[model samples]
Target: MKKIKNNFICKIIEKDILKNKHIKIRTRFPPEPNGHLHIGHAKSIFINFNIAKIYNGKCNLRFDDTNPYKENIKYINIIKKDIIWLGFKWNKKIKYSSNYFNTFYKYAMLLIKKGLAYVDSLNKFEIKKYRGNLKKKGTNSPFRNRSILENINLFKKMKIGKFQEGDVCLRAKINMSSKIILMRDPVLYRIIKKKSHHQTKKKWCIYPTYDFSHCISDYIEKITHSICTIEFQENKKLYNWILKNINIKKKPKQYEFSRLNIENSLLSKRKIKILIKKKIIKNWSDPRLLTISGLRKRGYTPSSIRKFCYNIGITKKENLIQMSYLEHFIRNDLDKKVNRAMAILNPIKIIIYNLPKNYKKIISIPNHPKIKKFGKQNIILRREIYIEKNDFEEKNKKNKKKLFINGKVKLRYSYIIKAKKIKKDRLNKIKTIYCKYYNKKQSKKIKNNIIIHWISKKESIKANFEMYENLFTTKHPEKKKNMLQYINKNSIIIKHGLVQKDIFSKILKKYIQFERIGYFFLKKNKIKNITFTCITKLKK
Candidate 1:
């Protein structure tokens, strides 16, 4: 373990395995294939994968696919893509809990032969009622004293589909009066007559409980340390109980850390699934949803996501991270990467009459202002150019800098120009403005007027830009009584715009800086032409 940046888990490895060079360090990231991977999962991926990389160990990508009803093949593929996209390479074969079903069944039988586990006929609700809360101790079930031979027959029957759902459950026969409720004879297996599993299809009707399978899966895979979030801390007692009764010497020890909690967003998979079902959001990949696919579609880079996780690090304490803290890292990552271009949203035309007819002048501007080697793009200076409509005000003011009657505004990377005339039609809207360009000698006299970005009216391509905000109105949206009450009504706003024709194409995934505007990403929609999504603002 590296002491310079040692996390709590690494310290455990140092004490447990470092002294004995024979035991190699190994870890695994096991995610249930139920939903799209979220940013919270990204933290776990970084911790598991990077720790292995740092210690010259191995990290396995294992899917804890215990629930066949909720798990989908599509979700598994998306998860695989997401992990690879985040720059973590796992074993090509991959691992699944369902793959160890036969072994898990045998382990259960071993516990039964030792009179440590048995088949119980109690329904789930009755069992939950008997398993009292923190204030009280639980009562043992009537079926807890069943003979080992009877339990073996019942278990085999459950596995062979002889039992229906809710009929019976196989449970670990631990002390019912234990302080932790999970140790009160927790269910080891349940009967579910489902036919199409992603990996194992219709071979068995019984599935192992997460509590029973998680620890054993790690043991079967020969993992050194089993790491998970703090919510599973209480379940650790149950985790160790299963491994202990089996008397496995070369097994893994579980470790827990705080999970990621971001303000104004909910990370619960079940809650997110509710939103999807209610049509509150478009889908899992909606730009405001914050899932891995959503973030990728909204133009967040993989490197930025990885950096955000690193900066947060691993802490024993749980804290709600401000959304702006994450925004800061992405803004910094994109600053020196994407090239700059000029785009005018809600543009108004400006005609420069000083230039002669049938004449054009080509001017150059650096792609990246700080790095000269990024090279320059050549744009032709035409008679007409497009500037934002907000740039032209009704009257000239001394404090505000815009295209006024006497205000001399510098066109970016070009000569100085002043508004000579204003034109508008119905509703008193400003449609066009006539301006006069200043020569090299006259340009030196300008002052106080701010420069603005624009694109040529004759050469620029039209585009639609979508600006996205948080999906929820409140900072803690999940706490609301009604989930719909706190939804942001206007989470998305669309506006027409014009971008420099020399660079922006109808289809491009690369990030581009739109001059005074924020960085943007071109959408991958084939039905719609030339649309951009706002990544973040560069105001900081």
Candidate 2:
């Protein structure tokens, strides 16, 4: 059995267990399926799922699909796929708030019959005016004093689509003078006519608000711990009040922890939608975005993400984590998992003068420098090859380590090569480097020679290398007045490159480290050429 770390929430659960508060524990990941889940939701998923795993409890994957106007069946499927990709399985068949629409209606009726809830006919603006701000006490609604029978009848009529949208709503009859405004008769159910719910469809015209449905769903599911981010701290009062008023015993408890906020990353679904709408990002799975789909597409492994969440842990203190902290984990993970391949991003041709024309030899290179179990890959070495343009120089400087004129450098896994001459194009750019190759025994005297990765021209394939950086230039773009100004123009830099044919080996993983370059994954796009996205730069 795995032991859970002693966080505040975990401690509370432990105390409950020791005191025999319950025989079994239940937790849930209740995401509203209006949009794809982001890294912030990854934290919540980690908490709920792992807590259930460590406690031998069951965690339900429940979609809080109360707002059918925004929610979609596609988004629900995407959410389920992401959770499964992150290596979590729901305790039972997937759950949805719509699954308990009848139960929720019954509970709402119970509230109205107990004189704890009332149907108000005030317009949205009027309702807002009556519900005052934090410093002011809200005034009672004009329809607040309606008789229980009348309120129930009005609610029934509202449910049956007799009232137009926003004309009437069901509200809890909590204190209007209470400092907590959410308790000031929060709207429970409202009229949203004609819009067909993904699940219920036109079977009903009324929909329950999140505040109303979330707690009830938790109670109906028998969730022992209604865990959520700190933004819901005040809502805990309402969550308990609804259960209490319904006269339900053994009510679930709501615990709040700080949400994950990374520097220069946007986790808000509304903001992400705006970016997509403006064509700034391709979609929810844009490699540059921090969404779970985006991260997976960018070659971030499930283990690495889970490890990152565990390292960050659950805390009530809100702090913005550095993006590099996440990069560090992926680097550590891929360093061991990823195989090595040679790719020339900026190619400069190299010709061995001493070798015969059509000279070719198949050589085996180890896939990983430290892991022999990864085995080796077969690559071709020929007379004509390509090396990184920056790997060679015409003019030799003091202590220059690259293949400069009359300077020597070792071609990795092959031979020591010394540049003899270079061919220049009309633009004065080095077109080709003419060099001589020496056997390892003959080059034994060469001291402090740098080794460079190279690929045979005939055996290499054309590829595009996509380099990615932070999407936002500033650390706290959310605080800025015009966040669009902070968008990093160079977030994605594409370059045409050449990759060794061995890169297509069957044993290769989704992501591989380009020798002398950074890590990369085969890009999944419709482009004809083989494309790879740079996961990250080599550790400095």
Candidate 3:
């Protein structure tokens, strides 16, 4: 639980502070509220919030909600919930880029008056063509040379919805001949005839682009360091250019770091949305997904995720972490905490023929090993019981040590039993295993070869158990031409199972380890006098 301080980014921030450069570091996590935050966002949040906390500075949760067509209030609320779930709190009230629309508009006008930016009449396709390639210089738009007065008037008209979508755009008047293509007059604003904004609503039709609004918003809020993904490294030049051109009192520095990537999942919101739209996935919060809500549904704890992030740390080099590493973290976190119970999956009836038919006894089982404070639960022992079919074998020739007919093994924490006979169905499939239990004191005198888990059939609860595996068959499912082609067909296996009667008495939502099996959570659906469902841990 000690604070992590070994990351290179933290060292850089410390170096800056010691040099008396950017005395009060202010950071911001600016997420576009178009979709649910993913694991990649978790890294950004951790770095930003922790840096601020380290320096005793401030971090702001700013929503870059300029795109009215894709942004929504639902996404905003979900983002807030996700940040809080990851254990981060902003220094002050939540802020949105849309709140500075009027300010951004005035700045755009300032650029026009100074002949630094102009309204371009080129359509979207023509603008891309004019922008040229990386090795070439772009041609100036025909409207780029328009008088400052005309360009300002056209920008005003676009704001009032006089132009159709993509008809006119505001572009920064940077050099087209510059080596960096992003420095070549990037589009600052575009016209969109969307319905309305979630916060602003119908006030304007023209919206500022991310490249234009991002840096200026940081300066407006007096941010000291703007941390973003490495993909925006090229955009950093334009970010600096806009701040230098504008008359901002304090300029913020932009830093880039590599975004996090998981081996077997798609992190793009667009791809996930397509899957959900095509019904390939159940929903956004499907347990197979890597979203926060999805992880929550899959029985992952917030603390475990935070620990996973901490272990991975922050870095500039991109990495593809194996999914097993995450599972290892989860197992390590839950092993000491979760209480233990016994549940038998794929059960076959075991008949104790030597025991009295009417005999019954209660045996005590500890809830947790090496933890005396957790107490114990009472398990009933009867004539009929259920054990996993995989725990037994039909023949002993191939495997002489196997648990077969006439073989001896200890029933976990109970007496030793010798298999008397195996009864097969008409198709020669083993249906019943008949055994004879040795007397209690006599069984304890001798050690059994194998220890197996079993539940009393008479007092057992019949339930349906679900075992989940990785949703993808390959390491990079999204990189393939068809994700479904790599889908793990055996991701989920359902079995008619049985568990000790003590487990059936509790209806809590918390997860519990099933002794030799994996962890399980109670399913929402309950059958009337017939069955119950529990979701098992994800297979490694």
Maximum-TM-score candidate: 2
The residue-by-residue lDDT of candidate 1 on 1-540, one tens digit each, is: 332233887777767765783266788999999999999999999999887877778999999998898899999999999999999998557999998999899999999999999999999999999999899899999999999999999998988888889999999999899998888999999987854787888887899989999999999988888889999999999988899988788768889999888888878899999999998888888888779998998999998998888888887798889888887878888887877888887888988878776657788778788978767777777889999887777678766767776567888888799888888889887878888989767887766358877788777877888888788888877677887788887888888887767665322347888878788887843323678898876773
Question: TM-score of predicted model 3?
Answer: 0.92
Deviating ranges (above 4 Å) for candidate 2: 4-6, 393-406, 436-438, 524-528
- Write out the backbone clash pairs for model 1: none
* Steric overlap count per candidate: 0, 0, 0
**Any runs in candidate 3 off by more than 4 Å, and if so which?**
1-6, 135-137, 177-179, 397-402, 444-449, 504-509, 525-540
lDDT of 3 by residue, 122-192 (tens): 89899889988887788888888999999989988988889998778999998877888888789999987
What lDDT does candidate 2 reach at residue 179? Answer: 95
lDDT of each: 0.84, 0.88, 0.82
Top of the candidates by lDDT = 2
**What lDDT would candidate 3 get against the real structure?**
0.82
TM-score of each: 0.93, 0.93, 0.92
Candidate 1, position 487, lDDT: 81
Mark the regions of model 1 whose C-alpha exceeds 4 Å error after superposition: 1-6, 353-359, 395-401, 504-509, 524-528
